[model samples]
Target: MQKPSIPRGTRDFGPIQMAKRNYIFNTIRSVYEKYGFAQLETPTMENLSVLTGKYGDEGDQLLFKVLNSGDFLSKTEENDYQVGSKALLPKIAEKGLRYDLTVPFARYVVMHRNEISFPFKRYQIQPVWRADRPQKGRYREFYQCDADVVGTNSLICEAEIIAMINEVFNNLQLPDFTIKINNRKVLVGITEVIGATGKEADFCVAIDKLDKIGIEKVNEELIQRGFTQQNINKLKPVFEFEGSIVEKLQFLTTYFAQSETGLEGVKETQEILKYLDSYKLENDHLELDLTLARGLSYYTGTIFEVKANGVQIGSITGGGRYDNLTGVFGLKDVSGVGISFGVDRIYDVLEELDLYPAETGAQVQVMIVNFGSEMTASGLSLLQKLRTQGIRSEMYPDAVKMKKQMSYANNLNIPFVVLIGEDEMKSGDYTLKNMLDGEQAAYKINDLISKIKNSH
Candidate 1:
């Protein structure tokens, strides 16, 4: 028989893994809520029309398209196959697993335009899929914790989003991280100044790879993409510019003096930065990065990317202002800004840095040990009482060996164990074992509840 295995780039999270993941999700959810973002959910699959052309050519290629059900090939024309995927994809696959939360969100807003409040604030925590090659911190199936506000062009949303990012990592106790901010308009301005106008998309695609491929390689890519060596030579100074946020913004002011569109992007970025200062994020944690041209074609204004200072991973969080995203779906002129927390990558960073608190793995507060059928009745009564008092307690289902039952509790990382026996039932006190130090003490029902609650 062939050994059973999950598809590559996917994983089956065990109890402990689930517990840690929940920690990350709950932290993000709490922050999203505190900032007035309500929870929202989108279907796992979105129409291919809704999913495509919004995320740029590369993103469209990575979409996990679903085959149309019930003899999918029956409807296809013989000539469509000769023309290839461009002609055949829509015939065979009308739906695709959502590539990200943002696009699906735009679709939702358009579909329910009248149902939701304008400048709607919503947060969605759910899995997204991609067909790209996956490695550490990148997965084909993973969750994105997203918070967004639509139907407004306010830069306050951008500032608030950055503040939320700060709070999330701060709550997670991830101190060493940077929030890199940039503007897509500034990128356009740079292209114009360097005489690379009309090649904005190509510039973003190449410059976005600067961190991964380094400058020399990036210059090579720029050349390959039809940029002149003069254009690259002008870009070199901008790439290597070192300064504080003020200095960087100043540099842009002078560099983009002649490009009106570039100056507009610069102004929008300045407004966002000014609004963010009152939030008082830590020194150097928020930075102005000129080279941060977020590759998503939809982003029209301020763009943000976050990196864990010490971890060797890609951006843990990123998002930007999409002025025309909803407009693409027929909600004309509605603009919004948002951010997404890459949960898989965040979990990887937490694991590598040992940031998760010790209590994260202890899901159940106490486990009631099972002796046999003889004592099962007393155990049942105690279990119900503990649960009624809001204690997370469970009992072993089987009348297994004492060693075996304790092994189960240990494996589950149960912090405490409650023992009720003939003697204890008669005495009206049960022995509680502290799993950490192997200490045993007798306690009544009320006392047991207090101890478990206090300890955990």
Candidate 2:
């Protein structure tokens, strides 16, 4: 028989893994809802037109396109294939898996423009696909937990997103994280200062790699992209700028004196920092990172990226302000700011640090031991009662041996196991075993429910 396997960069989650994954999702969802963001979901696939061009050239190259279903080859000319796959793709594929939630949210807002209120706050937790090679903490298919508010340009929206980031990591018990904030305007300002004004996009793209490829390669790339050595020299201070948030802002203010757009970005970053001061963040610290140039072309204003304090992982979360995302979908002037929590990477961090709660993977709080056919009926009724009392539970399905039933419960780390047999059934009481401590006791039916619920 052929060995069973799944595609690379994909995973099959078992019971324990799913339980832990759900914990991460639930924690994030609750925080999103608490912040007045309503849940939204979009289809996993979007039209090629909607997804293409939105992510820039490299991003477009990574989109997973779905081929036409039937007779797909009929419309394709042999010469089209001979020319190149890129030339032939549009002939066969019309749709592609969604690359991210933000773009689709933009499309949704435009399509339902009539229904949505201004400053629509929505949260989406969904899987997105990319065709890129995957490695540790990076998968081709993974979930993005995004919260965005559209139709407003207030800095409060940006501030609240920062607060939400703090809340999420704190709730998840993440020990240390930094919320790096920067503005596209500030990046644009850098380009302006360096005299790379017309090539701002190329400048941002090259500088965004400072963390990935380091400053030397970034400088080389800037040179390759036609930035003069003189202009590249002007950008060195931006790479070297460091201090408290205030100090960084002061530097930018002086440096961007010539660029109004750059100064506007400086003011925006300062305002966001001031608003952030009102909150008491536990695990998240705000920093004005001059180098944080989110490479996405759509970002127009404030941008954010999050990194785990001690873990050597790529950003676990990122997003930014987009002034014109919806305009592309025919809904003009709808400004939105948002952030995305990278679920899979966060899971890896939690697992590597062993931070998940001990009981997170415990699906059933109680398990009833099946004594035999004679007692199965009573066990079923007792199991039903436990469930009705808001307790998660189950009974051993067959007339299994006592040792086997107890072993099964132990394996799942179920806290309590109730035994129902001739004596307990006749006495109108149940035998409950505290699996963790091996403490045994007897209780009336109602009392049994109370004890189990309270103990858990």
**Best model per lDDT:** 1
Reference-based TM-score of each model:
0.97, 0.98
lDDT, candidate 1, equals 0.91
Prediction-by-prediction clash tally: 0, 0
Which parts of model 2 have CA positions greater than 4 angstroms off? 280-284
Give residue 302's error in model 1 in angstroms. 0.3
| Per-residue lDDT value at 274 in model 1 | 84
Candidate 1: deviation at residue 385, Å?
A: 0.7
List per-prediction Cα lDDT, in the order shown.
0.91, 0.90
| Stretches of candidate 1 exceeding 4 Å from the true structure | 282-284
